[model samples]
Target: MAAIQPPKAQYQQVAALLRERIHDGTYTADQPLPSEPQLSAELGVSRQTINRAMNLLRSEGLVRVRRGFGTFIRGVPQVTRDAKKRYAARNQGTGAGDVEIKALGLTPRTEYVEIGRVPAPAAVATVLSIETGAPVLVRRRHLFANDEPTQLADSYIPWDIAEGTELLNRNVGRGGSYTRLAELGHGPVRFTEEVTVRTATDDEASLLELDGGQPVIDITHIAWDAADRPVEVALHVMPGNLWRLRYDWDDPTADEYPTVDGEV
Candidate 1:
């Protein structure tokens, strides 16, 4: 005899019904969902099955559970634009840091301004193609969204290019560093980014106010000029939960011309 199966997949069925109801506004945002036991009784399923279903929804960022109370329908998952999109945007306004938080209906602010020349890390020096321990101007900013710290960034630029300009000033002025660079005749024509996800360091965890074991997205930005000279190297650290990176590309390779890669 075949083992007994509960008609079909109970958890998925329950989750689908709940998702539809939520979509139709039968369960409103921030509104408490029915208790697992109540749902189990109503759906004619086991409490365990109901719980798994709720957990599935939670993983989708569509709902949150309040132990001993009940689950609640949450608003749409807040998402930050893909880093690539931000870099490619036309320079008509503020920086990506400013635009992102605002789009999410949160005000953006920068604080903890520590700007000066510092010895570049060996990895950074290699990417910048500068000698290790060479002095580079470092601008560190702690970015916040709605008063909550969300990103920590350290921008490294060649000392010659960054010195004697607003790049060293508290304000980058006008469009941003790109504008300044254009004025200096080394405006970026191409960009490259190395993206990674890693566990946060103790200090990073503290600064981002992250709970134990939360990961982070680390991005290394390298901007180059038309002649293939690297002009900027910036390191950005963003809290894992606060942002989602997206990339939409036409094709990996469809041309014989030199694309993003430095191949000819």
Candidate 2:
């Protein structure tokens, strides 16, 4: 027999109604929400249950409460990021920065970009299969939407491959670094990304313009050429509250069981 599902709780029903109102503009940024007693009467629930729902909203950063005043809208993110679409676009030669933002009706810009030679940190070196403290070309940039900093990325390339090339330029040409690398016969054929999240440091907090107590996602990407040589290692940091990472599941096209190598 199939298991029976429990009905929605009183607090959950109240919270859903309030969320709908907020999304539909019934409640807006800085607008005060109805009092618990009023909501209780409106929803036919107890004041205590309504208060619980209000607290849930507060925890979600949707509302704030003032000691003598009432609850007010705090605001929510309008930006969304789909990881698969982004990477696939890059693989197909369309560079980053404009596509997604334009779809959301926001302006996108590369607010800052720089390239320089630097000693590879131990972490980056390990992922790139290079010597720790070895010289590498660092390409750093801050991605912005509507003039608000949203993402930061630092890409490390082997000095041998970057020296005396356009990769040294502040801007990485029309199709981005990957396209430039392809011309140099070191184009990336495969990439692996590892992700983790943690609290932002002071520098990260300032650069990303993150609010207090906001966390950031750290994504490390290791790119390999056709010969399986590690060509690039990039570190991306995104403010957790402003960006949503999306992943889509699909059935495997190749053999189901594969070993450490790509072979099945």
Candidate 3:
């Protein structure tokens, strides 16, 4: 005999109905959704079912809940420009060079947990073109905005080049290492970057206040001077959902390109 499927409750049915209404624009962006008790009575469902449905919407970014302020329909996702050249143009004259947080459009507050010379790890040595165990200046910083962790940056600069500079002794508010590097005569005119995404580790989740299983974006950058010498190697981990990467390209006839539809 075939196994029987469980029967759906009236409350489940009602929750589905309400979800459809919201999706169909019955509840517009930033519009206040009906209270649980009100929706319960109107849809003839229990409050618990309505709550569950709302939770689903929240996870999807379709709704937002404000403590003591009720839930509201989320605004449409902002459109992001994808041209790398356009991105550079937009950032031009923004004083974004050298760890300027404003160029990233994020107000940065930094916790300078450590700043000193350390033997380069194998990975750092490879990136900086230094031998293993070579001393390098390591700067570990926790960057925050609006009291939330925005990024964790670990910068490695060869000690021979970086030592005795204001970059070593300055606090977070002074300027970014990139800017200081220029002042010390090793300015970078070119940068190469690699980006990846993965689920956050336990420690990362705790520090970033991210939910378990939430993915974060990692960006590794190697900056080189005009002489093609590597000057700085930095790693950054950022919240996936709160940030968007934009690139503007000049070629209008390029054949191959990339695209995204919802979560990857």
On TM-score, the candidate that comes out on top is 2
lDDT of 3 by residue, 1-264 (tens): 989979876655665776688878887755688899998888776789888777656545456665577787644331232323321342343322222345446455778778989999998899999999999998888876645566787889999888787667745223356567777788777877788999889998778765556678887778898789998898878766655667544697543555454332
Candidate no. 3 TM-score: 0.62
What TM-scores do the predictions have? 0.69, 0.70, 0.62
Error of 2 at 167 (Å): 1.2
Q: Per-candidate RMSD vs. true structure?
A: 6.8, 6.2, 9.3
Alpha-carbon local distance difference test for all models: 0.78, 0.78, 0.69
Worst 10 residues of 3 by lDDT: 78-87
Q: Across residues 1-264, which tens digit of lDDT does each residue of candidate 1 receive?
A: 998877658789888999999889899865688887789889898999988887777656567554555677654345666766676454757686677766778778898478888888898899889999888888899988766677899888888888888888878887788778878988988888888999889999778765446678898889898778888888888767667777666775677667687878
Q: Model 2 off-target regions past 4 Å?
A: 1-21, 26-80, 90-94, 248-264
TM-score head-to-head 1 vs 3, winner: 1
lDDT of 3 at 199: 86
Model 1 TM-score relative to the real fold: 0.69
Candidate number that wins on TM-score, 2 or 3: 2
Clashes of 2: 0
